[model samples]
Each structure stands twice: as structure tokens, then as C-alpha cells.
Target: MFLEKLASKGVTLAQLPIPVVRNEVERLVLSYAQQRQWFLWQMEPDGSAYNIPTALRFRGQLDLAALQRSFETLIQRHEALRTTIGEEDGQLLQVIHPCQPFELARQAVGTLDEGALQAQVALEVQQPFDLARGPLLRVKLLDLAQEEHVLVLTLHHIVADGWSMPLLIDELVSLYEGYSQGREVALAELPIQYADYAIWQRAWMDAGERERQLAYWMSQLGDDHPVLELPTDRPRPAQQSYRGQRINVDLGEALGLSLKQLVQRQGATAFMLLLASFQVLLHRYSGQADVRVGVPIANRNRVETERLIGFFVNTQVMRAAFDTQLTFSELLAQVRQRALAAQVHQDLPFEQLVDALQPERSLSHSPLFQVMYNHQTRVKGERRSLPGLEVESLPWRVHAAQFDLTLDTFEHEHGFSATLTFATDLFDAATIQQMATHWRNLLQGIVANPDQRVAELPLMDDTDRQHIVDGWNATQADYPGDTSIHQLIEAQVFATPDAPALVFGEHTLTYAQLNRRANQLAHKLREQGVGPDVLVGIAMERSLEMVIGLLGIVKAGGTYVPLDPEYPQDRLSYMFEDSGIPLLLTQSHLRETLPIPAGLRSLDLDGENLEGYSDANPNIDVAPLNLAYVIYTSGSTGRPKGAGNSHQALVNRLWWMQKAYGLDASDSVLQKTPFSFDVSVWEFFWPLMTGARLV
Candidate 1:
């Protein structure tokens, strides 16, 4: 319809020919894309990671001769299908053979089941192609019955890509239809072949075009290629793995139309919108501001290579900066600007970009980007329906993960759908399944409210949120939430007064004995005017006396500040200044060597006389909000800093430990870590509060 209007207005669509390569057959250099494939083939010579297979089930009166002839005609038209790559002078070059008679191999299986037929298709896909040999494209036909047939077409990615598959399908249908009806082959003659385009591409790049495109890409992507730190179910392998799985997501017909309408309003292409949504999803999952996703462009802007079947795909990295303040509409604009610039400079060979950027080489991930995004306009197995056959597309999943994760979205007539391909080595199927749902939710949120912040967009539905927030966090157990940490120990003392509480080498203190001794020290601390909000420093080794000192200070309604005796004098002095402890509890043996600040009173616990103090719990009132303890950090930067926690918070942590680990009276937790480390707090108090011994 649009073409009719243009024709009436005297405006024709002109496809000017690209200059053809003249008689250049002797030394044909492989394109940069093909060279990259050759390098990959050398790395994995026996793997089918690069095989591209397409299968279809034909149920009708099948014409065997015309099917065979269609295969020959395809190979004859595209020289790359019959070509092989060979090495000479340290350069991988193309070896295009003359037109040869191609024969489609056929296999006869009597009434094979569905599973068996699928297995046959997978067998063809997994068979590695020998790039050094002649035929880069191969086909096989399986005869299930007199009227039912299955055609499997496999091509090495070196000679074909995602864009070339549809061209082969459309041409095969047309050619088979013509041949079956005994009509002449009506396909137009190509202006140039794949070899001619490869040669022309090299010539075009050598004349300063390479530098021009390289400058744009370098300025856009730069030398920095941050690996997208996607959370995985398992540890990543030391080397990359091709094992993968795929999941399909149906966005529904309404969502599909909404996406198209949203794109039209944003003044952006569908690719741009989907890419932006992908960036948003990645940013939310990774919590990263800089998100880099690799997008594959067809690289067929020129008319000459439009109909050719070859590997002409180029990858462009679309990097977006995200933040909580940026709106989705703002993000779309940013993506549009970057996407347009990328398309303008998309001709730079991805291999050359990798060489120039020189990102940190990794065997575990693809350089420059680990995530891939692609939108397909061509439907799989979509072709002209032949005269006498009902064609049904048979899915041939190569199950190879080319990248860490690749989201391939497809545009359909009434709706849109997507398939997520993920590396099984790093991700479980469930993880990828959630990721697909999250991506769809993100797209839905974007279409609903374009002005909302991208960070505010919903990536999950109610059920998913419920599973993560409520179901996984069902560790709720009743504990004394309003009580202080020391009060719990007192309750334990009442429940099992005769149980062993503290055990050191060659020493032990029962619950009753420990509470009575702590009471005596607590009375002495009260005489020193230590009350609520006061900080008393405890500097001592890990001994039975150390436990009494900490418990005594807290019982006197004062916060105990832990000072590791093993720390340097300078660090200990800084801790005293930061904590402002007017009283220091230490052993008499270290009084002479310790750095005691002037006017700071120091008491030796080992030498103090407590014969007259009452062996009863103190009567001080300490609320749950009162400061419990102050722990000084190592302060690797400069001076030490103290972090204070409330008694309520400390008790909550101890209670959680008991519920999580199910600690019982028979269990003994070894308190080997120093008092300064936070882990030691749980190690010290968890067992004490749960009727378990703390050793």
C-alpha cells in the first residue's frame, strides 16, 4: 500500500549496486567475522558449539527429487555454502570451490516415535562441521512414511547466522514449489556472491573506513568492559561452557500491541525500547549503574549482501547508566541516542573492537559483555506454504550457550514472545525462569507508566514477591523482644541453675556460681559510679574473669567497651579516646606495659578484693534500649572507630542464632574468636541463652 502511494508520487525505491569484485578468486581473504569463527573452531575442534540447524516436518505428498534439487540450487547460488576455510602464511583464507552437484542424504526409519525423531534432529545438530573440509552446509531427510518427511538443514555459523536462516527457508519454499510444479526456477540472479561482498568489505575498510568506525566505537565503549555480575545458582567454571537451556515467555497479544504503541509514542524503534527494558532488568538484578549488553546487528545495510547467505552479523555493545532518579522515559531517550550512534558506526568488526579495546581476557566469559539481547522480526519456520504439503516447524534447539545469557525476543502478528537462553553451568533452570518473568514484568511496568523512575518499575508480580519476602523469610520464632541481653542469661540461670555455663582450660563455672560471681563484680562496679550511658573499657585476655567483667559492667547499667589486649599501644590509645572510657578493667600483670591515658582509672580484676560484696544479682534498672557494648574496628584506614549496639539488638541477634541453629543444652559452642570480632558475640551469648554451654 505504501509502495503504491510512492509509485503514484513518482518516487521509486532504488537499490544502487555495490561495486562488484572483478575476477578476484586467487587470494580470497575471509571476512573478519569468518576469521573469528575459524579461531573458535581451532579452540574447540570437536565441539558443535557453532552449528546452526533448522528442521521442519512436511506431511503431504512429498517430492523427493524437487527437495534434493532445492538443496543443490541453494548451495550453487551461495558460494559460501560450498566453501571451506584454510590457513596459509598465518592467515585464515576462504577457499571457494566451483559449483558442484550436491546430494541430500536420506534416512529411512519405519514409524519412528516423536522422541526418536527429535533425537535424530539433535544428532545432526551436534555433529561438528569440519571447516577445513569442503561442504560447510549439510542436509538430511528422514522418511517416516510414504507421505511424511522431515528435513534437517545444518550450517556452520562461519557461513551463516540468525539472519541467513530465513533467507534459506524462503528460497527453499519458492524453489521447491516451482520445481514440484515443473515450472522454471523464477528466483532473480544475484548481483554478487558472498565472496564478492567479503572482498568488497575488506577494500571498504582499508580506505580509512576502519579508523573512522574504530574511533566511534572506542569513544563509545572505551577500554573499560565491566563484567556484569549476575547472581548465579552455582559457582562459575574456570572455563566457558557451551551447555545451556532455554525457556519461552508468552507476553500475550495485548502486551505485544502495548509495546508497539509505546514504541511509537517514544519516537524510538522497537529494538531501542526492548533494549532499554533489558538494561533496566539487568540493572535491577545486578544493582549496577553501568550496564553493558551486546546486541547483534545484521550488518546488511548494503543491498548487495541482503539476499546472500553468510555470516555478516556484527555485535555492538549498548552501555547505559542507570540510577534511581532516572525515569523510564528518560532512559528511552538515552537509549535512542546511543542506539542511533551505534547503528551509524555499527560496521566496525567486533573482533577488531575486541583487539583494540583489549578488555581483560577471560576464559569464563565473553569479552566486552556477558549478556546478549536480540529482537527477531522473522518468525521461525515462517515461509510460503507450498502447493501439496502442510509444513509444520520442528524446533531444533542447539542447546548451546554462546554467552552467559541471551534474551531473544520475537515479534509476532498479534503478540510478542521471548526465549531466554542461559548457561546451565552458572544458572539453574528455575533462576532463569524467574528472570524471564521479571523481564516481562519490567516491560509491562514500562508500558503502563513511562514517566515513572526505572528503578521503581516492577520486576516481579505479587506471587513472586510473596515467595521472596514472606515464604523465604518464614524464620519467625517467639523470643523476649523487649528484654535486655543479660536478662536472658538470668532467666536461663533460673531455669537450670546447676548447669555448666562457662568452661575454660582446667576451670569451670556452673550457672549458679557464674551468676553469683558476676553479682559480686557488679556491686563493685556500682560503687565506681558506673551507670546507664557510661562506657567502661574491658581490656583482658579470654578467660573466665573476662566473662565476669563484661557481665558485671552490663549488670551495673553501663556499656562495656571491648579493648583487645593484643592491639598495639597506639591503637589502644585511640580506642580509649574514641570510646571515652573513664574506667579500664585489666589484669595487674599488664598495668606497667599498657598505655594508660592520664587521669584514666585502671582496675586490676585479678588483684581486686571482693570478699565483702554481696553475691546477688544487682538491682540496677537497664532497659532494652540502653547501650549494651561498644566494639572498636581494626581501622585499617587510620584510627580505630567504635560501633555501639543496643541491648535489644544484641538480644535479637542471640535469639535468632538459637532459633536458626537449634542449639540445645547438649551442644557446646567454642568461643575461640576474640571479643572484638562481632561473631564472638553470638558465639558467647547464643549458647548461654539457649541452655547450651559456651566454651
Candidate 2:
């Protein structure tokens, strides 16, 4: 039925060639990465298929001939509109070729229900569009009355971003008005095509500009790359997934005025005030003296670029270190100065900055900043309406990204609204609710006494703060009264000894079988002279053996460093050398790939057991404070730095989870994450400690 309606509207797929210049190969590559291609298909690791369609809706009485003419002229004026992909000398490139005039159709609806028509338009617009194959652009018209109509346009992400929408709209309106009056068009010629800009960018980067930019980033991000230690009841995930929620906070007129007055007294702006408040909140919540966040800068400094549409946004990392002795006003001034300095040096792209700094990428978190703050002033314009038609702009839907949390603020007529978007998979609704309450309390406190020091502020007045502390200290009642991970595992050692405890791909390991294998590995490690204060490197693919190897090292009273097999050999060697690993555990299949130092002993975890060990064994006495594992995160030196954790920390986290979520052995958790990620740590140990089944 949908296809039939589309067919009646005269919409059809058109083939065109996308052109590219040969000299700008590097730019082409960069453009490929920057250009969004996810729209073409929705995919999962498992094969499932879906199609995306571009939808357009129109309202009011329409002039079909005039609209068609306007569209043709507009397409002819923009080179990108007629571009398609083609192969040149076995290389894919954008070919600039003319397309046949787009097919247009007119549909008459006798009914005059405005609300129903708007709903229908919204439904059509919500459909996804695939952009990888080609440009997915559509135009629709809705007749609201005999003299009025609405035009709806939809475009694929591959061809445009938010910046491009304004340009397209301006051009469309101008062209449509000219065609309607049958007058010769008067439009300025584009000085440069999108392709030219891409080529120029590549050339500019290759001409020593990129190196200078890199140097600046490296110096800016110094040593001691510390993470914001936000207390978490559960561990972090390895790979980021789309699971998020949003909360909106409105600042009333009085609060806004008070904030302005406070900022004026401190010689700063409202943005600085907000940033300072957030820094204090982060300091209190994360218990970190220093906090860093990523701020997006619109790179449209050039007058010409203000009109051109593209991805011209770059991220600036803002670092704020808080001391309890410093007053909020003083901190605001400092933040204002630093923010200005960052703005002066905002030419570097985030991706390029990452490559230059080469920070150690962590599975549990982003390489740089996890939190984002944005403040935008809306554009002013009067809404244009056709006769007998009322057109209103709809609120944009929230699109999830790979950040831990993002907050955006926009100036409203009366005051401002701060929208907080967070990952739902990592944070529950209760947590977000508390966050909102805490934010309001912080803002109110600052407004009440602008000269108050961050530590001197009355945080006790906030109920969420007390709630968080109470929740953090709460104890779980579902666990076996008072028992540790080792004690609980011992209790269930015989009951489910033969049941499958771990499965990966085609491989499965029973509880008894896994325990015996771990014991054998532990014995092997002991033979290799591994013990307390020693770090054992576990380098292998994501498999059941990898998990077994990690558990075994800890069981053997040595800390384990998880080495992702996908990491570059140089990086792997650096981590091994830096951590002073005396021994490594890996599969024989990857022996050639991971050639370690001659003195470092290596054992194959995948091969047959060299030591004859029985399942029955004397219980090993493991202490709660013993070293458990070392997780390597991003370092300022372009190398990974390992963060060591004690068994106490892990167990404390498990106990925190038990108290917070009431998880027990009866709960079955699907271990779908990799071990390198901290989130998997919870999924792996919490169940084992509570006698819970790990599916």
C-alpha cells in the first residue's frame, strides 16, 4: 500500500555519477570518514535487512507547475544535488552528472482536516533514509486551502547535516518565488563547490598545517590523564551502545536575571557561570579535583563559510580543576579566561587531535572527554505562511550518540532550558531524576550567594545528594548473608559442577571443567614464577579461554593485564614493557603475531594441559585486598597507562550492586560484552558471587 501511494506520486529512483578529483586523494579519504554513511542500511552483526525511504508532506493549495520548475532550477544550480558515485580507474569517486527532471505528481484530498494532515506528514517524515547508495531527497506538497500549501523536504544524512538545512531552505524559497513571478533569477554564483573545499582541505593539511595542529593538541593535553572517578554501582561497558534518556530543565526569568547579575559582578558571561556550576557538580559527584569536558565549537569563522553548508564543527576539550578553597566567582573568572584561550586555538578537528595525541583508547570509555556541554542562541526570523495555511516548525527528535552524557542549552523567550541526555543502559531513570534535582539545587545555591566557595555551598540542602550517599552505603540483603566471591563459589563448587558455566561460539565449559582448567593454568603460572606484585599479560581473541585465563591469574595471586589482540604490535609491546610483565598467556594460534621479549615467558592456554591436575584441589586462600586486574586507559603520551585495582574494589562494587539492584544468584545475566570492558567485569563477577547463572 505504501509503495502504491509512492508510485502514484511519481517518485522513482534515479541513477547519477558522483565525481571526484584525482589529486585530492587524501581529502577524499577524510571526507569518506566525515561523511555519514550509516543511513544506507541498518545492520547488526547478525544478518538482518531493512530499507530506508525519504518522506515528504505538503499542506494547503499548491501550484504543481511552479513547484516543479523551482525544483529543476535549484538542482541545476547546485553541483552536489546532481552528483552520484562512479568508478574511475578502479577507484570510487563522486561524478557530477545531470539527472533527468524529477517526477512530480498532484494528489487532491477532498477532506479539510488540518490535524490529520499534519499527523500524516509527521509519520512520513519519521521514516529512515539510506544515504550510502546515493542522495535520498524528496519533496512533498500539502494543500491546506485553495490558496495555501505546505512544502516538506527530506534529505539523507550522507548528503547533508543540520548546517545545510538553512542553506537549502533559503535557496528553495528564493527560486520558488522567482519562478512564480516568471522573472529572470538573480542569484550569486557559488565561488567553490563542495568538492573543491574537500580538495583544498586535504592540501592544506598535507602542507605542514596538520603537524602544527597535532603539536598544539599534544601539548594541550598533558601527562596525568586522569578519568573522572564517578562512583558507579555497576562496571562500565567495553563498546558504547545506543541506550540513552533525556531530561529538560527550565531556568525561570528570575533565576536567569540573577545568574546574569552574578556573572556581571564576576566579569564573565552566562555560559561561564553554567560551566563553573557543572564543574563543581562533577567534582562533587565524581570526587575528582580536576574535571575535563568536551565542548563543540562552530568553525564558521570565515564570512564565506557562514553560508556554505558542511560539517564545520570541531570539539574543544575544557579542563577545570577545582579546589575547595576557591570561591565560585573566582572559579567562574578562571573558566572564562580558559574558554577564551580554547576558542583562539579551535582550528584542530577532534579526529585529527586524537591521531596526533594518540591517547590510549579504552574499551570502557571514550579517549577524551565523556561529558559535553553546548549553548546555542537561536536564529530570529518571522514564520512565513501561504494563504489559508499555518505552518509551524516541529521540535527535532533526539538522536543518540556515543557519549556518556551530553547537555545542551538554548536561550528561550523568558529564560533558558538545559537538556540533559544520558545513556539509559548505564544510568537508570532514578539516577537521572536525582541528577536533575541536584542540578537545580546547585544552581539555586550559586544564585543565592555568588561569593560562596564550592565546598562551602550548602549541598546538604539537596535531597539527591543524601540519597546518593545513602544508596552507596546500603548493603544487599539477598546475598548469602555475609560471604565473599571466593566463599560463595566454594559453596556452589559441587552443586553445579557439571553445568555449563561459560559458552563462546561453538565452545562450552562446565563449572567443574572450567574450575579444573583454571587451576591447571594457575599451577602453570606459579611454575613460571608469577605471584603477588607481578603482572600477567593475557592476549587472545574474545573467547571462553580469555575469561578463564583472567580468572586463573587472579586465583594464582597475580594481577592480569588484558591485551586486546587487535591492538597494534608496537602498542602491545609498550604496555607489556611498561607494566613489567614477566609472563604472558595466549593461544598458540596467535604466537607469531605476538612475539614478546626473549626473557618474557609465554604459555599457550589453548593447547593441551601440560600439568596433570585433578578437579579436586585444596581451596586456595585469596585475600580481599589482593590485586585483581589492571585496566589500561588512554594516556597523554600516546601510550596506554594501566590502572591497578584491588580485589577489595571489585568486591565493594559487587556489594554495592547487590544493595542497589538486589541482584542475586537467581538472576540470569547474558554476558554479551567483551572482558576488556569494565562493564563486563560486573556481568562476570556479580553473578558468580551471588550464585547467579551467567547465560
Candidate 3:
């Protein structure tokens, strides 16, 4: 509607006032962006990770001389094209070279097919440029056929960026359109060059602007620098592997329109809505509450720098906290607020942000954020036309990745075209392909129901859901049914009476000896009112007696909770109060440190008098559905949450372990984990029930 109103009033974006920096003098000091590139270039002297190459194809008769003249004039117009980095007095600076005769490398490969042509293009893209020896830009012309030609423009990142690509292309086309017609028409000369703006930027930042923007950034970032832990196919290497490739993704026109409408209804831009959905995807992938994504903002807000060809782009970190309970609309609101705030503070150079925050540096990953999201509207390409020629943009393979993962989306006539560029070392092609599907699926889900919880949003289709819930879990093997955990051990005891069941220090209890001791304690426990479904607590360190106490309680049909003696008193007291245990079995030595509640019946396993109890097996009616044990997990929140498992579940897991690993008499299973964990449950019982030695 606002655009319609502008159209009604005969107002267009091109009519707006656009100021350009017009200075008579230039400065040698490099811009902050150039300085960052220089440092990286020094680190990897032969690395082409920072190279930028774009290609265009012409399918008509091309005047080579006119095109060459066009490039010569365009390169002379922008000093950045001829600029290279050098050092003066131990400080890096930009040195501008004089305008020299242009030489467009011509490669006549008319017989080469499409794939072979791209291979040659990839080689050209990978060629390294010498920053100190000048000529940081390369122009290559490939004569593919009689009436077809391909032009490749490659530049070092220190001189140009994404924004410069279109500007450079438009100027080059316009120059050719005029020169080919024997006309002298040309583009308006820029009032100032990139070097003049670099000087002006230093002066502008010195007038308290840099510190003013820094305040907002410092507050926004604080001490939080979260490393994205997106589960990858492989572990990350110690240093960054710049090797990368791109895969195309297309979200249908309908989904794109629906997403755009949803964004408009929420009073947010497309970037904000898409970024919010991306955060949801990352949170789902990593199960992290906080996500930080780096976005490259064309920091050309100042009209003076918009038309100049230099590395005017700066990265801004978009940091936000996500919650599973947040609705899609609610999450978008937060993203919208953060996006607007970041825009206000976008002038703060990312290089300076890294310098000021001084995060723990690692070569394996990027600082602050390792994933990037970029959105572009390719209206410039559609608007650009060359005289008497059909132009189609050709793609050159990406040989390096600037981040662990980067999503670059372009809005074109066909709705949305996206490509996910990822580090080849960390992820496989299929992982990224599935991620693209998930992201698209998430966006469709979000638009379908904007009020739904972000966590409840669909990231998988029915096929994926079925695969995860049923296909991968096709572990259908037969095992003994209706058997209690103790019954399995009883069968093992009968099969191997002399096998070692429990070992601590030098003392070893064979199956028969261990079962006899446990039976006597079970009988005593039953006499002390320990029966079915009764709660018992065993607080002791790792020892043979600790195992005996738990096994004895289970034999007596009571659920035992293992409490580590090394825990703090406050934690112990909280656990005791939470579980409401009636009986506690501990040792005499640990009684001083135990946080025993009032009216709790206590017995010391070593000090108790169980001599009169029968050594035979106690005929207790323990069912498979009875409560087995309770394990408390200290989760992200400080509170401990107790979860109880049934005997059937435990028995099934142990049976599956026995079937899978086939532990027999020769195997010695080491039980080192404390009894409070589920791993300890299997470590103690799986071996004892399978006639394997428990060490």
C-alpha cells in the first residue's frame, strides 16, 4: 500500500537524493574492512578463500574490442579495482596503482561442453592474486561457440563485495551498450573514489560515532558467545577447512507467497520472519536455548559509499534466546525487535566488535557465530540488459566456505531460490539436503499455523516421522516374557553357581554366595515392613555392600533409590523430602554425613544382625510391572527431577543388551559408574544376569 501510494504520487526510489563522497585528496590508510582482509591474507598467504568471482554469458555476436574498452573505462573510474594492500612502517595500508592498459585473458574453447567449461571456470576462480604485486582483479573471456561468449570477473575481497558485483556489472554493460553503437555516452563519474571514503570513514568514526554504536553492541552481546553445535556428520577439524560447495534449493511459489503474506500481517519484513524460522530450526537441531547467527549487512547506509566499488559490507551478529513454548508469532516479535535494534547499531564494524569483545580465539571455528544467513532480492539482474545480446548469469562453484554453514537465498520471479553452502569437512551433501528440506518444511508449518508453539512446529514430513518412530526401531527380537529382574538373576545363579557375581577390592562373591547373602537381607527387610511398592533409599559410596543393599531391597519387592554420599547435605535433604522414602540403608561410617530426615527407620547393612535370617532364596511375589528404581537427573535447571522406571522396561533393556553384545562367562563387565545413573543399572545387572563377571 505504501508502494502504491508512492506510485500514485509519481515517486520512485531512483528519484531520491543519493549523495556521493567527492574529495580532491585520497588517504593511504586502509578501511577497517580492508585491514581485516589483510590480516587473514597474511595468515594464509596462498589461500584463495577470500576470492570473489562472478560470471555472465552472452548468446549473441559480441564486439570484443568494445567490451574491452568498456572494462578499461570502468576499472579506471573506480580506484578500488586497482588498489592493493601493503605495509608502511609496520602498519597495513592500501596503495592505489596507476591506470594501465587493460588485458582481458581470452580462452577459445568452442569445442568444450558445459561441464568442461565450468571446470575451467573453477580453475580460474581458484587462482591466487598477489596483493603486494598489484592487479587484484582478473577478467577472462571464454569463446564458447560461434555466436556465444562467457565473461568471468574475479576480484579479491579486499577490493569488492556482493554489493559491488551488480554495480560493476551494470556500469560495464552500460559502457558497452554505448561504445558498440559508436556513441560516446558514459556513466556519471563518481564524485570520489573508495580511498577518499576510507579516509572519511576514519574521520567519521573518530567523532564519537564508533563509541556510540559500540555501546549498543556491547550491551546487546554482553559476555555471551554461543558456539553453534549443530550435529554434523563428522567432528570439526582443528583448523577451518575452507573447502565447500553449494546445492540449490527451491521453496515453491505458493509457499513463498504465503510466507510473505504472513510476514506482512505481522508487520515484519521477510528477513525477520525467515530469520525467526531459521532460529527455530537451529534450536531444534541443537536443542539449544540460545542461537547466534551472523548476517552480512550491506553497511552502505551512507549514500556516499553506495555506488563506490569497495568492500563496504560488514557483518552483524544477530543474537537471541528461544524457548520451546514460544509461539511462531511471539518468536517473530522478538526477532523483529532485535532486527530493528541491530539495524540501528549496524555501523559498528564487526572487526571492531571482535577486537573489543576479545572472545576466546580458536582457529577451528569462527568467533561469536559460525553460521550465517543471507537474503537477497535479485531485481538488479532482471533490470540489467546488454545491447543486442541475451545475458544469463553463469554459476561458478564455491571452493571455500566463510562459515560452518551459510544459507544464501535470493528472491527472483520464480518466488525463492536458495542455496546452502557448507564446509565440506564437517557435513555431507545429504545432511545439508535434509536441512534444506527441514527449513522449508518449518516455514510451511509456521505459515500454516502462526499461533502454534515453535517447538510443536513440523520439521519433518510423515515419511521422516515414520522412519524415526518405526523404521529405525525395528528391533523385534523374542525374549523371555513375564520375568522379573531378580528372576533373571536367579536363573543365572542356578546356571553358574561358582561364577563371580560381585567383586570389590580383593573380595569376590560367586553367584551362589552373593544370592545367599542377598536372600538373608531380603528376609530381614521383609520382617522390617519392606514389601511390594515400598520406597527405600541406599546412601553409600561405590562398594560391594552398596550393590548388596540395592539388590537385597529389590529382592524384598521394594524400590530402591541410590543416593551418592558425596552430594551436599542440602541436595540430600531435598532428595529425601522429594522421594518420601520410609527406610534408609547406609553404613555406620557414613551416618555422620548423611542428611537423615526425622522418623526415618535406618539400618546399617554391615552392622545389622541378620545371622538368624534364612540363607535360602526368599519366595517373594515380585511382578514385572512393579517399580524398579528411581533415578534423579540434575538437568539444565538447578532442580533434580526423579523419573521412575518399571521392572518390565529394565528387563527388556537388559535382554536387548544381552542379545546385542552377547556377554558370557569370559566377559568381565566393569561397574564404575555411580548407582544413581541408568547406565549403572545395566552395568550392575546385565552382567550378573548373564553369568558375566562384575568387576
Candidate number with greatest TM-score: 1
Per-residue lDDT for 1-695 in model 1, tens only? Answer: 32343355464444223444535345778888998888888888888777888888898898888988888888888887888998889877888888888777889876887788778888888888889995888888888999888888889999998889878988888889999999879687787777777766676676567899999888888767799999989888988768887888888898999999998998998889999999998999999999999999999998778888999999999999988799999999999999988888988899988989999988888899999999987676553467889777888554788888999988878767889999989999899888988988998899999999987999889998999899999977787778887788898999999999999998989988988988899899899989887999998998998998988898888999988888888888778887879899999888877788999988888989887999888868888788988887777886667888898889888777676789888999999899988777788778888888989
lDDT of 2 by residue, 1-695 (tens): 32233245463323111222433343233243243233223332111111112222334444566668877776776655655444456554555556667765444444556566656555445555434345455666655556544555765443445556667776766676666667767778755555555444554555566787667667667765676666554567775554555776766788777777777787787777788888788788897887888887766665545655444566788888788698887888778988887776776667677666666777566667888788776642335464433334434333344467777777656666687877655776577666666776788899998788888765545355556678766744443333335455545556777666666667777667777777777777776777765789989887778877876787677888888778778877888788888888999999888858778888888884746854443345656666778878756576577887777677777877877787654577788776666777788777655556666
Better of 1 and 3 by TM-score: 1
- By lDDT, is 1 or 2 better? 1
Give the per-residue Cα lDDT of candidate 2 at 316.
82
Candidate 2: regions farther than 4 A off: 1-59, 62-74, 80-100, 103-131, 136-158, 177-185, 223-235, 362-365, 379-382, 458-695
lDDT (10s digit) by residue, model 3, range 531-558: 8788899998777788888889889999
The worst-scoring run of ten residues by lDDT in candidate 1 lies at 15-24
Predicted structure 3: lDDT: 0.85
